[model samples]
Target: MDAETNQSRQSALGDLALVVGTLVAVKQSVLPFTIVYAGPVSTFSAMIVATFLLYRRGLNWAALGLRKPDSWWRTLGLCVVVFLAFVGAAAGFGAIADIFFEDVGASGRFDFVKGNLPGYLLIMALVWTHGSFFEELLFRAFVITKASTVLGGGRGATLAAVLLAAVFFGYRHYYYQGMHGALVTGGIGLVFGLIYIWFGKRNIWPLVLVHGLVNSISQTQRFLGA
Candidate 1:
């Protein structure tokens, strides 16, 4: 195939895979299963399909922005910035959500960890694997890359992709968190998405680290009842 034709074919496959993954997520969310099981089912199902699609195009996780950074120090610095941005965004959006709701809805899902050392420890173990790594891979890496490509691969496309992915990311939390949680989480997603584009979309390690840090802190707060 010619270059243009090959590119077109790849785009088509990406679109298909994106749609399939999204549908799977939506279906899983509404199923009778609990969030603990449903969340992983949706995430892993989408990830498996995404991986298969990428392999068909001779691409892999690296193509979805999973590569290592050139400098650990620089990446660590970026992680700090992203983490601060996450806090700012969460607080800002949370304030806005408070205006419409009595309080910004907290996910009761994590209440099990409140003042429970064992529960906190259990979730902390999964924070890196399920929360940080896979979530970023699916949301930031896969969603933004495929969305940007489908939208025509430019700055505007990337921004739009970020917004679209942020909304989806936020909605995924809606099963456990109400609209307030979705809004706050969505804002955080926007921050992460923008940072992914700003850093040239070559490395997701920084975001992954920041994500883990955020989850860890949140879990710790629950453990301490802070």
Candidate 2:
């Protein structure tokens, strides 16, 4: 590789190391504050810190996969594909789980829906978008980028980074959603991770939309069932 390529690789690796250390430490340190503080504040703080580090290192939005789309039509097509892929995968996995485990039935989600469809919709939109976009931004974009850079860019490194983020992502949801949620979210994380890598980490608008759609569908079904 040329001197410039070598330099870029080194820089990416350094960024990756900084990112991993920050995430690990921030997650652990912030837990103690949950009694007095809660919700997305901790994540928001971590995001701000990560952004500061990137800016200090002279990293721009493009470098962080924040590129603009070429055309609206193209963007729409990409959105459809991502939506189908995400929903289809989620359904397939959920079905498989249902078949193997009788106890793992789809019950609780609909309870919320049946009781209050409108309320569920509103809550889901807020939670999913906030959960999906920010989580994606942090894990898929920021964390994956750092890991990929540090380990070098290739299939192995990419998959490794995805797995690493998925573990943490899965853990984050485990408390609220239980083991089932953990599995589903982890699976979602893996798919989203691949999509980000495949698209070279461009604007994540479509992913956010898909996430909202998926959550809406899931919530609506529950409400209707109830």
Candidate 3:
């Protein structure tokens, strides 16, 4: 292989390692350290490692699909579409899970926000940063891009990358959301992945907006006891 191909593979391998390391750390410490703390800690740590890796290649966050959109209005429209699709997907998947599982429990971690003004406010305050931006950056952009590259970079590889990333994204929530939640979230991830590519992989703003909307609605429902 040429030097360029070799370097690309090596970088992809580094990204894989980064992802695995972060997941391991989160999984190991989540129970004892708590996701509230462990989540951000692992996320930022992975961000740091990712940044360093990008620096080595003289790239930036933009390389991980954070480019400016061609049209703001188009992105906004896409966000609305994606948000509705997510709601439908979640409901459909939840129904499917119900057929097999007796109790598909919710994520208990956010239970403290239910009917609690301060907790709700705090979570809402960090919703964009913690729930939307970072999650998309890690699970969608970073994982899909690197995974596709690692899989040798083709149309089929990209689809497989999306599937793999979606599964991992779902697994990340299993610690708190149980199997049902994981499956639902995984379905959501698949939607996000497909849209991420369909809307143009270079721009992630639409996905971020959609994710923020989902989190905001969920948080509001919890706050209002819905």
Candidate 4:
């Protein structure tokens, strides 16, 4: 490649690095002060900044799988598929978990989220918005894609990228959920990664739906004391 093109690519990557670093810093800073202390605003805000930066650098929405799909209905159908896959996987893993690990720290999340109806209602909204939108943008769109390229693009790269994202996803939950919860959440992250692969990295609508639904359902179940 020519020096000019190479220079442009390097500059863009440097911006991406800055974006990711800023995101981590922002998320870490806001957690102690907010009700949604997990910092969805920070995550979402960083993404907005990153999107603008990437755009200025000539990166399009497609690079983040944000393009409009050919058929919204088809994407909805894919949502159903991924959601069912997630539900089934969660149940299966839970059953297996019941056998070996008696206390998996799953109840800790429930205790934290459960509250009076008003508080619970607020939590439901936060869970869906944060889990579905911001987390997906950060983890699947930017992290997984960049990880794949950084690991050296190929089949091996894809596998490594998916697992890399999954591990980090689970690790994010580790503080709240402990080892068992982290492992299960990691498995769900793996499922999301698979869905991302199936979507051909061209559309992430289904992922957003599936991810939102998962958190919404989980919150509902917890609210119902189930």
Candidate 5:
């Protein structure tokens, strides 16, 4: 292989390794289910390692395109639009499905009777924060960028990365939320992948915030229901 091709291969391999490492860490952590779900330190560590690999491999942070406009208002507006657009779309689709399927997620929606509100809120808050940061770091910043670097700009690589990450993201939920959760989370990953590509690897913080906001809303709803 030529020098450029070899570098691309190495970058792609690094991303794959990062994803695998994160999955393995999630599987092997000794922390209690609640604790691990709440904090997600294993994922945090895995992403840190991924970032190091990217840096060592001379991956460009600028290429990741995380920088935002200088105006706080503009940034906040963009974030709000992105978050609402995605969440609204998901809700609309879910509502439509409810018409035919009898509230598919209603059973798992919120169980306030079984758990106290305070504890649930605390756990959800932690998870929302930790989960968003770790997920974006691993999937968007590392996985998508690495894949793009290797596969070049085209539909094939983008679709491949989205599908692969969606699988992993779905499986990650299976341990906690079961089959439906896996499906929903996988869809979420797919959306994030599209957004990552749309943004040209820059400004992933919006995605991170949007993700956290959605999780926070779900958690709040659950808490209130409880």
Candidate 6:
């Protein structure tokens, strides 16, 4: 490569490094306060920040897969099919694990519904809106996009980004769900990461919907006292 091309690539990477560093600092400093004081609105702050960063970087919503697809119905249908498949797979794994571990995850996951309408509705709303929205944008879009820049885009880079981000995604859940839930969440994150990569990392709507649906179904189970 020519010096000019190499120089340009380095300059771009430097800019990305700066942006990512600032975001890390901001998250470290601000997230705890938001978690304590903002409740569900913690993610609202993240959404706002992500939007501003995207704008400043001259990135459109297309960066996060907000484009017109060939068929919207096809996208939605695919999401539904993927969601069901994941649930079925998870159930099978849980059953097999149960044989040896005997209720391996019984105490690790969240009970979202709480046996009440208002509380259940609130939890569902948060999962569908903030949790799915901010999480997809944060992890699949921003984190993966920025980190993948270092390795450059290729099959190897995509795989590396997916594995790295998926592990961190599982770590994100470790506090609330413990080890068993963290591992399960990490597996889910790997699938979502692959979906993001498959779509050229330009669209994560399907992943968002799948995540929201999983949380919704879990809440429904809890509501039914299962």
Q: Give lDDT for model 3.
A: 0.80
Prediction RMSDs, each to the true structure: 2.8, 4.6, 1.9, 3.3, 3.9, 4.3
User: Where in model 1 is the C-alpha error above 4 Å?
Assistant: 1-31
Task: Count clashing residue pairs in model 3.
Answer: 0
Candidate 2 versus truth, CA RMSD in Å, comes to 4.6
Task: Candidate 4: give the clashing pairs.
Answer: none
| Total backbone collisions, model 4 | 0
lDDT of 1: 0.79
Candidate 5 wrongly placed segments (more than 4 Å): 31-39, 59-63, 92-121
lDDT of 1 by residue, 105-191 (tens): 455677888888888888897887778987898888878888777666778988998999899888887767788888888988998
lDDT of each: 0.79, 0.67, 0.80, 0.73, 0.65, 0.65
- Rank by TM-score (best first): 3, 1, 4, 5, 6, 2
Candidate 3 C-alpha lDDT tens digits along 1-226: 7899878978897877887687567556765857555666666667777777777778787876688878889888877888788888889888886777545465567888888999988888778876788788878887888888888888999999999989988887777778888888898899889887786367789888888888899889988988
Query: Which sections of candidate 2 miss by over 4 Å?
Result: 1-39, 96-125, 216-226
Span of 10 residues, lowest total lDDT, candidate 6: 34-43
**Global lDDT for candidate 6?**
0.65
Candidate 6 regions with alpha-carbon error over 4 angstroms: 1-42, 88-112, 200-202
lDDT of 2 by residue, 160-196 (tens): 9888777777666554466676677777777888888
**Comparison by lDDT, 2 against 5, better one:** 2
TM-score of each: 0.87, 0.72, 0.91, 0.80, 0.75, 0.75
Of the candidates numbered 1 and 5, which has the greater lDDT value? 1
> Which runs of model 3 end up more than 4 angstroms from their true locations?
1-3
Among all candidates shown, the one with the greatest TM-score: 3
